[model samples]
Target chain A: MTPTLLGRIQTRWVLLWTIGLAWVLVVGPFLPLAGPSVGAVWLAGFRTLLIVSIVGTAWEFVYHGLQQLRWDKDWPTLFGLLVGLNEGAVAYVLLRNGLPLAIPGLTVAPFVWQFGTVWLVVWAVSNGPIRVLFPRWRFAGGRFW
Target chain B: MPRTLDPTDVPTVLGESDIARQGRRVLRRRFVTVGAGLGSLAMIHLWRLAGVADHALCAIGPLASPSDTYELLATNSQIPRHERLRSDSGSTIDAIWGWPGYALREAVEDSHPGSAIQALTEPVLHEFFTPKAGQVYRSVDREAARLGWSRVHQPGWVQMIRRAEGGGYWILAESLDDGPIAIAAEHVHVAIGYPGVQLLADLQQFRTDHPESGFRVANAYEAHGYIHDELLTRPSTVLVRGSGIVASRVLQRLLDDVEHNGAQTTVIHLFRTYVSDAQGDSPFFRRPAGNGFAYQPFNYPKSSWGGQLRARLETLDGEARAELIDGMGGTNTAPRRSWRRQLKRHEGRGTYRQMHGVVEKVVPTSDGVRTTIASADGTVATVDAAYVIDATGLQADPTTHPLYADLLARSGARRNPKGRLAVEPSFEVTGTRSGTGRLYASGAMTLGGHYAGVDSFLGLQYAALRIADDLAETGALPRIGPARSARGWLGWARNRRYDSNGVLA
Candidate 1:
């Protein structure tokens, strides 16, 4: 990649790393520990939680800044907030609880990977809409609803 | 505006009926072209904004003459009364003595929601109220005649005043009335609407500039099929763009034609957004909704209008409506109940298919045109089509219309990226930097301004009401207070009955 593109990626990674550290500090220890016999489930849950918290917290700040600074109240921010809040909450619970139930196995990787896959699918869907109705809406204003 | 001519004394020329003669006369009157300035884009904006405060007190002055006169006639049967209303203004509305589409009408009247906008409303309603074709222009000629106003076949501006003491408007002809009528009213509404055939120039240029790409597109609008017959049919593999109402109809027509001709033509439709086929899952006929196509409205009552959708949007705000329109992929192509059943039969046929792609460049080749398509997957494909019909959507340039050109030149109105008029919520074009007269716009031209994706019958009616509201503020057209009568209220109540009812119900 060109230096400029690599620089952007580097900046994003640094920011994510910083965020991941902060998340681990605040919610990591409080998270339930995995049962020794169910090591895989516990590791899967912890990793899932770590990724969600990191991505969600990062996106929330990004979208919040965009909405406030750019006046870009359109899709990116609105949708980001929606996905962030919902998926982030799920990841948070899984990380906190699933760690106690984990059983050791490499298959535990699916927990973290599932969300990334889903994110890619959602991102694809968000690129363009499918099946729209024309003259699709009407708006009322000026007190006389 | 009334002209006295006995029916018996009327002369027949070219075996034409009196109605046809009158239509011709109306057409002739509109041929009076004026070389008014397109004016400043700034001025246009100011005029639209100014119109709002001006129209706040404007009165629509009761539905002129025959409208009032007809109501009186309806009360008693003594004098022989015509079934329809004929005004001194020469316009008449066909009377379907009984409510023909009362079921849909009742639904609109009854459950008209309060303007409460939230996300998900557009989709929720789309599943309920579907839009139909040719409903917007159904009564244009009738409405024009009723007002004794001739339809302007060509676009232009006429000086409402000859250099008035303070200098008045150069009114763009929405429709022309008899004898150069002038309303002392300050606001001149330039509802040039969508700039007809001139709107397609960009797409025309796009297809023309790129001849080597082999994808075929079919535009909803065809003038003697010049583009379709000459270009579209020539391609072996065609990829049509857009998913609006017109696009839906064109696809149906293509399939119908292919069936009729027994041609194994491969058709790929590109929809920016995929709406659930209103046809659902019947094996024989399922079809996508109409998201981009709007044709002549002469065929409406036989087809349905988006009466329910209008009632639904009446509850949204400008930003919310924009979001809704954007979410709906900026087009209206609700599927017809019957047509859906037919389209479903071709699931595996090479004759028809749907794909999503965006065009970056269109280049012409020695044999045919080549199109470079970037599918949503980021895969690039270069294909040559015998013909390309850009049913993509309306691509208009304000500069193309003489009045808008004049207005844009002077900075009265500014053009959007799509080259349509940029207006405020009140239909005022935004760039009148001075913030002066508040010149409001209406019709298709204001697509992006306030109610984007709005070019349907109810959409037009909703816009008409907005214009009427502004006119009411101006006191030019006297105000008839909002519908509050028991009967009017009853009409409203009766209309909302189907708000929660599904189409199948």
Candidate 2:
């Protein structure tokens, strides 16, 4: 998507609220059901969601700068995938360091699983179904609304 | 003998004598979109989404669909139905929304997710996913059926567009079966595509000088299948010109014949300006280049579609916009692995060679055609070949089209720096606004307008969207909001018909 700064910010927020929130809610309850978990795992999911959204918003500015450096001012699909890794790392570091709020039992495995799944689902939907649902998304630089 | 009339006396409106002499029948509509190809179809699709009544719209041209002309040119250029076109998966002309793009549909039909995967990881992990020509044609056919194309389509060749007596425009056309017909519309859209295939001056001179050799020398966009057929039957040298996608396709076709049928064929690929390596003025803007070809995924940069470049171009005027367009515009082809491999394999076997020179002249010999080439240092040489295919691309001059020329003259429309019809950001032709009537144009004729990729499928759709929005502002149709857009997409998905009030039935 050859997104302008505004387009990137708008698309990130829109997809996070819809696709990201929905996926977190659907998978939140199942996490505690899989095995014994600590206090409010769903709450932790919401916390993680909050972190990704806030961190991702900041990341958009960096992406916009990087995009300007390139002639096309666009990111290939592969770059989009790679950015997920970069964002995941940043979110992981912040969550572990208690930047927002520290969870009672936020372990590495669960955090990885939860954060990784959310990222993948969001990315996949944005590339495919989101485009189908919002026809103007691509032409508007990935901004649906 | 011809009689001369005063220039000032010439009327913008056709007189009764002119109409009676031409035996014209007048048809009126609220909207008239010329060029019944992809561009017209795209615009009409937007009108349908806006809930414009079928009776209020008219599309006039000879072809029923864009595929009619596209397939012809494609086949002539060695891209048959089964071959893949150099277009992105989302650049589908069949649907304006571009939902369930060709990749998803093809992936489902073939029971393979390769196309889908390619679409997601293209230009880095893999080459871009391009839909086959047959698949695109089939999709367009389905959409055309749903659009009820026949109800609004009028078969005719547009001859002229002039100011009407009242406020609208009069479109004069000649119907092969029904004689002359004139259309009156408040809103007019011109999307008549490229003027025609351009032949190099040397080739044109050769064709005129030797009529018999005309069959041997031809533009790649024209019908020249006989050259390939003859080459497969005999050992002969073929001179391929240009370094664009068409040239690559033609070269692949020739090499494929040799590989599959064991035909003995030789190819002499000529380049007017060879690109030896990656080169550009700035490191940030350098295009990938190798093997005398400048590689680009598409004709224009991706940003030119909707991002920074698009915004930049829209804000620029005169020479600035033209300069930006020139930097982005040129003859470049997608980097196909198979074509590159074929070139390398043939080069090693002494069956293929590349030469850099300008063709100073071309003359037909008893056995073949001979071309005089001059190199950069003024070194001269001649090469004789059984066939020469000029793949230099098509003519884009607006004046070459009679209808466009007449409209420009009568409406006092100005041309852009690139000599194309100047269009407003809304795709409206400049200086063509009369009262409430507006004349908008798209496609190659408006190449140097606010958009860079005006000729692409996606570019055409973008233009249609802008025009639709403009019409909505003028109270011609309702603006498509999020709710309306959702309804339209659902209707499209469920194969529901569009009602007259912008609702799905």
Candidate 3:
């Protein structure tokens, strides 16, 4: 018997997507944008790193840091390349292909524009072990992460 | 962190990697039965009552039996010893049958003549009697023994359900003494019951701030016997939160203390939503208390189980259906005549008060606790209570359970509009079907989808019967026609065991 590739997603997938998106939303565009005019590529890449690393890490809490399943440095790196990048691209493609699905106040264009950018921001920033830099989370081979 | 192991090593001496053992420990096992297995408490009872506890089905969970936790709650709750359950008497744990029901059977067996009708009309006669929690326990345990429950019931904490490369699900579970037991089955029924309460944010913060509060503030499900021992005896004021059955029961318990011990129990009944005029406008023509609870007789209209209301619910989709659940939902009780009379007595005695407000904060005061409440009528008020009990219901969040967490994490399952599992009519979890291995679920975690009364006794039986029919249709089980049903009924009556699935035939 073999484990599904979905293993990387963590047991609480809802918490992963939910708490990740929620944390990103609550923090909003409040992270001081790095500089006067950050590169769009850097913005997207940075967000992907943050969303995946932070929220995704939170989801993996049961099997990681708190639990005995030690953090594997290669996990975020591998998942970033394998899952995050692909998810972002697919979400983008789906958003584009499904042209005009209208809601109450907004048109499809702005909706997709906002939705895609947020997803991209999530995709860019959510990478590995960034939380380890925070004073609180530094433990369990935190220096290595 | 899942591992890919050879089929031969399905986790050591799990079901059968090598030598055979007696009872639950097996030598070897394989299956092509349709919907080869089921999950949760519903599955446990099904195996026992269907007399298949020794056959194709085995209930594996962290409990010795399905109703272990539930029976404990029933006994512990302050509900009167003779009080009838809110569910219909005809609904039972017997998967294939609902015979003499609870009241009549108990009445006849106990030699309490004509008490059956009196039990149903209860409170009116000042003498209602549902089956005692003891009766239910004895019945289930009796059936369990007859059907060799311990022999087939795997007592273990399920860790994960990963897809087997050969198809079906590889269920990995750990027994405290026997280590990990991995069983490969075509179907898994997941019913991990309730996970108690995740107190509202403010209450949680209150607990965090006052680490030594002890039982002063706690969920209604957790025992707070101090109410009887210290608070009620000392003429204390209790801040009771929520408006559902638990709230009503707590209020009743307080009043009982007043009567028994002559304690001056001051009750501050707080409600987040109050229906002053319970028979509200636009009421469901056939249903009562659809506009919040003025104490509805039952949880949902009995029809919601499998009658006209259920059919209507099935026809609805998305927001409309969600709105129905919300409308019918809230702290509800049947407003039993005796409980209501007791409440009236207490209120007339000037010891009980009802208020509608959302608690904004709770800060410790010199004598007790000062609560900041924002009233429903655009007003803020302060109330003091020696003890605060959160009667808000169990935390129904599916993500709290590890198995559900694993399912959502991997198997593509999605929560419904109400934030519980979205399941099909067969109670099959929507996204867990792979090859012939289909997964089914029931109980509170699957409340809003197709089954409105998903947590009720009848709901468990209804879901099990529906799933069993689905399995039988797919050749996983034999259809219990009249003959088989009758024979199975007799086996149960005679305390003999015969597998309803024909697995042992």
Candidate 4:
């Protein structure tokens, strides 16, 4: 996808608000019921969302810089898939180590499940449904709105 | 209906001198798109999206639907209605936004999740998704109907575009039934597709020398199904020339007949320059090559559509732009697994062979044709084949076309370094401005300009968008901002006509 910096930021927020928020609300309530969670699972979910959204904006700058090095100035779908793992790992490390901020009652299994599921859903939606619902998304460099 | 003019009063060559001539019925519009093909269709779609009414626009061409000629050429090249084209899923012509692409639509229509998954993971985990030619045609037809294309369509062959007395241009066209008519418009868009198919020099000479053996040689872009029919019934040796996508398709068709229909066909594949391995100016830019074919998912790199290459090209001009275009240019085909397996099996059986040489001559023989070939090392060889399929591709040079040739001679328009009609980043034909009227061009005729993939579906849309924006800047049409875009898209979804005053239906 050949996303401009603005396009990347806009898509990030759109996905976060729609798919990401829906995942947090629907899956967050069930996370506590599935396993032992100390603090509010919903708080952790919202915190995770906030961290990724803010940090992802910075990642966009880095991605844009890397894009310039390539002749095509675009990322292959494979690269997009791979970058999700990188972003997830970065988010995981920060949440665990409490560098910027910490998510209460966050465990490895729950964090992995939530983060991985959100990434996959977001990726699939962006590649498929987003294009169908918002016709200008692809032409505007992935900016849905 | 246009007012009937006396046939004898029409001038042989329309110019400023004939502007005062009587008996000329001049229909005027704010915009006129010359070729009623995908390019023109895209431009009109964008204009309508920007709230331009149908009455202010005129589309002049012989075909009623934009995809008519495209469908014909595609079918002739072995891509029938059901067969998938070599186009990308997002390279849609009907919709300017390029959303709800063919893949997504196919996924929902056929209830096949695999199509959606394939589109998502294309050129990476899976082969790039290409829509069927029939689906694309159907979509274009539906869109043409929605846009009320009949209202703007002028049934005629555009003869020439001359500057009007005061402003705009006088577009002269010859109606098959009504002789000649003129259209005056402030803006003109030229998108006449490829002039015709191009045959190799030796093959052209061969056709010239042996009149009776004309049917023995055929261009891939033309109807040559008789060869396949003949091969199905009898044993014959077929010689395939060139190494483009069409060459591969033709090869696959022949091998398919051998595999499915049990035809005893021996295929000789010839390549002017056989690419055995990955090669390019730099490692990062290298294209994968194997089995005598250079592999690219599409005709050009995906980035050329809207990525870094597109941005880079806009900043370049003349020889620099031409050099970059050449770097990313050449004959390449997608690497389909089925084609690979078929070729491998045939090669193993000694039925399919590859030859590397330049064709020196082709002479008619009793059974077929004898082709003389010269290798790079000065070695010469001859092969006898019952049929020859030249897949060198279509002629795209604008000078060879009568209309473009005349346009260049009369309109002060210049050719780019690559011998195509020069165009700016906005797709305006350089030096072709007449008073308040401006001439813009797109498609194959405007290749080697600011865009590398000008002939592609997305490329045409990009050119149209650019032209629309340029016209908006000149106060010819309203700018399609966020509010207007949203409203237009709503109308598009509802299948309502686009009215500038926000009225639907």
Name the candidate, 2 or 3, with the larger DockQ value.
2
Instruction: Let me know the TM-score candidate 3 reaches against the reference structure.
Output: 0.69
Per-residue CA lDDT of model 4 for B1-505, tens digit only, reads: 2343333454434555585464456677788999899989998888887766766888888888999889888888899999999888878888776666789889999997888788877766898899999999988988887777887888888877766766678888776556677787889998989988888778888888898998899999999999999999999999999898999899989998998898999999999999998857675677778998988877877777765566667789889989888877788888899888889999999889999999888999998999999976689999999999998899978877777886787777889988989988899999888777889999998888988889888988889988988998998888766666666666666677644332456
Order candidates by TM-score, high to low: 2, 4, 3, 1
CA displacement after TM-score superposition, residue A139 of candidate 2 (Å): 2.1
The predicted structure with the larger lDDT, 1 or 2, is 2
> TM-score of B chain for each model?
0.52, 0.95, 0.87, 0.95
- In TM-score terms, which candidate is top? 2
Q: Evaluate residue B464 in candidate 2 and report its C-alpha lDDT on the 0 to 100 scale.
A: 92
Lowest summed lDDT across 10 adjacent residues in model 3 chain B is found at B27-36
Q: Give model 3's docking category.
A: incorrect
Model 4: per-residue Cα lDDT at residue B188: 95
Which stretches in model 1 have alpha-carbon errors above 4 Å? A1-145, B1-140, B150-167, B172-185, B196-218, B224-236, B271-325, B335-344, B360-367, B397-400, B409-411, B414-438, B449-454, B482-505
Residue-level lDDT of model 3, residues B244-346, one tens digit each, is 7887777778888788877787988888887655443532232243223465556764445543356557778788888766655545666566777787787
Which residue window of length 10 is worst by lDDT in model 2 chain A? A31-40
Summing lDDT over every window of 10 consecutive residues in candidate 4 chain A, give the lowest-scoring window.
A31-40
Cα displacement (angstroms), candidate 3, residue B408, comes to 0.8
TM-score of chain A of each: 0.31, 0.87, 0.32, 0.86
DockQ of each: 0.01, 0.55, 0.01, 0.32
Better of 3 and 4 by DockQ: 4
- C-alpha positional error of residue B220 in candidate 3 after TM-score superposition, expressed in Å: 0.9
Could you give the DockQ of candidate 2? 0.55
TM-score of predicted model 1?
Answer: 0.44
